[model samples]
Target: MDLMQWYQKAMSSDAYLEYMKENKERTASILEKFSIPEEDRELLERIGEHSLKVIAITEDWCGDAMVNIPILLKLAEAANIEVKMILRDENLELMDQYLTNGTSRSIPIFIFIDEEGKERMVWGPRAPLVKKVVDDENAKLPPRDHEDFPLRKKEMIQRLGNLYSTDRTIWQEVYDSLKTSLVQSILM
Candidate 1:
């Protein structure tokens, strides 16, 4: 099915609702406080009638998804665009097609499909700063050091948690990038 079909199906799905409900804390963290700036709002408005579909391949329980998806959702709403989500586990074939680094099956992959279901762009995993923290922290760990893996992971988690908690400008950054990307995609 195309994105619109999937979107309609997902919206009324009890399973999907359960997923969202289960991740209420994560979702609330973003949805409760996030807002679009005037400039971002104007950019979204310009995308009016572009008939875009943001096919978000994600799992509700994913920490990254909870933080970033809501920000994209806000932009989609502003642009009057329909946002669709496909659970990664349930849609393995689709998810596999858009894997991170062609190996890691990362959650929260945002596939921008047009009215005809042609993918125009893809984004995922996390924002740049978050990715940096994850990469840098992981880099700090020594290879095959099982003894300290847990400790390193915990420390990385704490750093990531702090980053997400303190960062409000990430949303604006998302808006700016998406605006540039959308423009580029169409001009090709």
Candidate 2:
């Protein structure tokens, strides 16, 4: 299928907002709480000048999406860009094309496309800092073969979600990483 055509078939931010309202409390909380910094106004304008549209491959239940989507919506609003959401599980044809590490079907992949539908850039899942935080937590867990590993892994994920909900610093990391990547892509 044509990528642009598929993007047109994706759900609008308004519909996704309704989906979040019905599906995930954490994502709704993040959306309500996150805000773009004042310093980003100029950069946001610059991004807007490009007239890009983004398709977010995501699911409400995803922890990474809990952190990333809210920030992205804030940015999209500030920059006057349009964004659409496509559920990853339901859109594997597109999700598979943007797989993380060419393996994992990571959600929250932002595919920024120009007016002609040519992909300008992609960003997603987690920033380096966020990944580091997750990795550090994983390192503290028991070996995968251990009997307690499953429980510990689930608890660790919960802890991370809690952290994402309350930690403004992690939000900033996501904002900064997204800004850097987007700015770089615009430059290119």
Candidate 3:
């Protein structure tokens, strides 16, 4: 079945809300702070006449998704795009279609479908700038450090959380770039 059909199937069975309801922690708090900027509002306008459907694979417990999906939703909404979310665990086949590094099943992988139901663009797993921070931090670490690794994990999560919370512009740029690329591809 196509993604829209899958979205309908997930929605009718209440699976969609189940995931949203389970994500109450961050989603609730983020709603208050999340705002689509004027620049990004302009970016969305460039989408032109294309009808886009963003099908997201996410899970409630994902820290990255908690930070990213809401922003994407707001920007997409500004562009009159429709977004449907499905949990990663429940949609492994769909998740598999858009993996990280060709092997890892990553949450928050958004598969963009056109009005014809063809997959057009994909964005995901994490924001690119944030991923850069993570990559830089990981490169500095001992590859297999057994000592204090758990402590390091805690520190890293805290640092990444700080990265997302403080560096708000990156998310908007991410949306801008994503929308720009989609428009470029469509116009190409």
Candidate 4:
């Protein structure tokens, strides 16, 4: 199905609306704090001039989704750009068309399309490296039988902290570049 159909189906779910309502206050706070540079802000304000569409794939249960989706919504509102939100699982066909490397399915994948429904730019989580980091951390945990599993949870926390700090830098770069590209593309 097309993006609009997927969005309509996903939003029709009572559970999804409940989740959004429950998180509304927190989501609003997150959007309020999201900072974009003055130049980027001005560029984004012109996003709809060339007719661009943004389809955001996300799930309420996802931490990154909760954070990023709100920011995207805020940006779209400010730019007067239309946006459609779809639940990742419920929109597998749409998501599959843009899946990173044809396998990994990550939330908050922003698909940017021009007026003709041709993809202009796609941005979201990186591939293999992300899976590797998550897998490696999972491997470090002792089996369910280990008596000291609880104590070793600290090691897991530290590992995740290190992974996140490194990953955050990479993600930030991608996000900034994507924002600049999207703005420039729309203005052109």
Choose the strongest candidate by lDDT.
2
Over 1-188, each residue of candidate 2 has an lDDT whose tens digit, in order, gives 87788789999988997877423777777778888889889989989999999999998888899889889999999998899999999888999999899999987899999998899999988999999999899999999999999999999988998999889899999999999999999855
Preferred candidate (TM-score higher): 3 or 4: 3
Q: Rate the local accuracy (lDDT) of all candidates.
A: 0.70, 0.89, 0.69, 0.61
lDDT of 4 by residue, 13-117 (tens): 234435575345545555555555566666677775666667777776554454556556656666665677677887777878877678878776887766666
lDDT agreement of model 1 with the native = 0.70
Scored by Cα lDDT, where does model 3 land? Answer: 0.69
Question: Which of candidates 1 and 3 is the stronger one according to TM-score?
Answer: 1
Q: Is candidate 1 or candidate 4 better by lDDT?
A: 1
Model 4: CA > 4 A from native:
3-18, 21-26, 126-175, 184-188
Q: Per-prediction TM-score, please?
A: 0.83, 0.95, 0.82, 0.64
* Poorest stretch of ten by lDDT in candidate 4: 8-17
Question: For candidate 3, lDDT tens digit of each residue in 1-188?
Answer: 78777655444113443446545555545545778777656657666357877777888767677677767767777788777777789778777777799999877787778887888887877667767877887776655657867778778877776666545675665566566667676656
Number of the predicted model whose TM-score against the real structure is largest: 2
Which sections of candidate 3 miss by over 4 Å? 11-23, 39-43, 46-48
* Prediction-by-prediction clash tally: 0, 0, 0, 0
Top-down lDDT ranking = 2, 1, 3, 4
